[model samples]
Target: MADLQDERPDTGHVPVGPGSLGAEDTPAAPVAGALDRAAALLAVHPVADGCNTLVWTLRQSPYHDIDTPDTGVDTDIPRLRAGGVGAQFWSLLPPSAGPHASGAADQVVSDTLDQIDVALALVRRYPDGLCLALSADDLVDARNRGRIASLLGPVSGRTLTDSLSPLRAFHTLGVRILAPGGAQWAREGLTAFGHEVVKEANRLAVLLDLAGCPPVAACRIAGASKAPAVLSNTAAAALNPHPDNVTDEVLLALRAANGLAMVTFDTARTGDSLHAVADHLDHVRAVAGPECVGLGAAFGAEPGVPRPTGLTDPSGYPRLLAELLDRGWPESDLALLTWGNALRVLRDVEFTARAAQHRRTP
Candidate 1:
């Protein structure tokens, strides 16, 4: 929630190799052809980036326009198109407790509302480029129209302010994803109230993102919630021992719950190269299955943290996919990683919400 600038130092290009592939490996593709293949694949299955902090950057400066090219941040319309990003989950990370944080509960709620306003306003401001997507169907519709499907995701459960009203309100306003406060949930695990939040999110068709959650809490939420959960912007802790990364236990739980573990680009969580990212992706796919892995670059989310080489911004996805391609990932699996899997989770959540609505009162 601080002023997020693109301060990542340039780590030169790291070549893709067979070393990045997991147990179920295929013969590596020629590196010269991988980029072309990646581009061709992306034409149909554009990247559905799970988390981006452009809203946070926009919130910092009134002059910053999302349509502007090279705004000294990670995301922009032109670069997004260049990156083959068809759908994006715009992360609204309102600080829960900070020196600049609101002391009162109402103010915190107000701040959350303000963040949503910023996201909605961007879509309204750029109707030709971005369209608000509330469901999986909407994402496809937007793609067909040649527009970027924008999904709202308010990170941190504290944004709800210990009540379900705000959660319902966020859903009504087109928020589709809710990631509970990881630091808080990690320390105490999901309390009774947290379970209520998950249940209500399920009913509302809001995807639960377990980005910063620990294994115990992530597994519990995955087990309890009918809808599939996601790690919107996290790496595999099996490779990187960071607190924010997803553990193998959580990955197995995702497999059982049909959830997604979107591999992040944060070098602090994963390692600092394209191959490091591929390694994490391979690990997640090997553990959680390829259906459960996706991309959540989390670009510009942590301003000072180092970004992986060739993945410093929105235009870098094709290169990352090329790395995967060179590592011998099939086109079908790559399609799921880029688009299908996220859409499936959204569809599943909507289905679960409809079923819950038939049985329970809102």
Candidate 2:
């Protein structure tokens, strides 16, 4: 743990990573403690047969508490790891400056890819004890063996700059899905469509479709993750209306594509703020058909940040599932929203990538 309390190394202003592992990084197996807790949850809730305890992991690297002032104040490193909280997949954001003339967002995509290369190398070296799960099935398998998975994605989608090539670059680097906006849209514009909208929704649609971007994959502590961008979803209800939430035009847009529509709700934020997004899901599913709806829990382990008015964290996931059940969502339909659909996207990518690799080798 490097005596973190006394040996607080002055790295000026740096983001969290392996260094934060602190005392927990000891060979004594800090994960063992988290395993013990998972054991307890498994004993009571017990992920049902053929069921999965989801970890809708996010990568808020640059924006994590430390940089956010009020949040970085006295974070508990050991406790986070001990809880075996949803796998902390490194959600690396790109740099604001330095790189090419193609524009700032594309530059970040390149820089972030470099960081991913480093992270991947570490996982490859410690496959037995580290990983980057590409699918929920991979997460279930890794949990059975006691390892963490790292899902790859940018906290914001601005890195693509309304371009297809950048999205391709990120996908090539194993970044399967991404959420387009963070507090607000990047240098681009507002995330939600408004009475007098600024950016083009069709452009956002083109970028997501090109990236095959979705929140279907998370990270692991050992090897690589596997998953897909099965469908596109957004939680930008405040500044932007969620097209995935459903309007005839939006529903037609989503229905036209073969993917899922995810409604991500930040428990730390007021749930009412996301109601527009949620109700849209209800309407979209009703009008577009059941296969299109999905859900996301945008939770942050950092303290002080309030959980959305309705949820309590990963433990609260099943409650939402129950709500969907109450609303007459079939078990099969709920499964697709909760895990199945995401897994299929990942598996498809893995299969496609491997097939291409095989063809190249031969």
Candidate 3:
């Protein structure tokens, strides 16, 4: 919801609402919206005593001047907290680097590293309210202490450099996880679905592991526009046949990285439906093993004001989970598919802490 603008001009591709933001809007507006949304959401789904939920950081960064000398001066964050958003992370956007670049992904990573000074200033500004959070464990400590932990993460993976400096810099900057791929398919080896068909998507995936920025989710997927409304994405499930959906190679990318892959169903992309995502997820579990897969809800945009599909935004997760379960899914298995998978991946990552388990009720 920051100052993000889509490269391609699509109607619903990047929707804007009262809480949404663009570069033109006053910087304060977006941050305030994020805080309001995050706080409202958390209030409804308060984290269990020891559980964790990360409010996307990029959702708040676009408003701040990416070119600011002191990126750490957090004028926007205070507004977010006032609205109830306790945590946020920096967004790694290629477009944010300004037009003209050798490579989209490369530019994003390079520019992101360049902003470390700003991030550091933030750590000092609100040591308790904001800290450079790097692992799952850090999230717990921050939340428990009533402070927001800033888990650093790349919004997408295409920005990584061949030298892995971007990855190293990300770690140094306190980014706890990485998406490793975005809507656009850059020249990286085995590109993510439908954004662009970059042949180099595969090479970069390997680089992520070698550099220690192992991904925590799958190619952030967007389902077919004509897909089924069912919670399980099935239409595009022909093993990533559709460019926007996860192909066999893409699924393998997550498995190889020992990362938890997530299938993000827009539930509103008219071009590609999400039925395939649901179907392929079952297939992924069959092939990639049970632990390496999950789902992400990038459902903030209001397609005709909460009519994108039958369900609403993130608030619709419980209903979606119910549908998946009714289709013969086990609750335990569903838990992982829903959130546990991502939680476990965070646990293994460095600079993060393991979540304390709650005792089972008799």
Candidate maximizing lDDT: 1
| Model 3 global lDDT (CA atoms, 0 to 1) | 0.37
Question: In model 3, how large is the Cα lDDT of residue 277?
Answer: 38
What TM-score do all the candidates reach, one by one?
Answer: 0.87, 0.49, 0.48
What is the Cα root-mean-square deviation between model 2 and the actual structure?
A: 13.1
Tell me, what's the RMSD of every candidate?
A: 6.8, 13.1, 13.6
Q: Against the hidden true structure, what lDDT does model 2 obtain? A: 0.38
Q: Which candidate order results from sorting by TM-score in descending order?
A: 1, 2, 3
Q: Write the per-residue lDDT of candidate 3 for residues 91-206, one digit (tens) a residue.
A: 33334532223455555655566555455565665565565655556655665676655644343455543444554455555554344343233333234332221112121211
Candidate 1's residue-wise lDDT over 146-256, tens digit each? Answer: 899999985456665456887888888888888774434333567777777878888899999877666777888899899999988888888889878888999999999
Off by over 4 Å in 1: 1-30, 97-105, 182-187, 300-305
Please give the distance, in angstroms, between residue 31's alpha carbon in candidate 1 and its true position after superposition: 2.8
* Of candidates 2 and 1, the better by lDDT: 1
In order, candidate lDDTs are 0.77, 0.38, 0.37
TM-score of 2: 0.49
Q: Among these predicted structures, which one has the highest TM-score?
A: 1
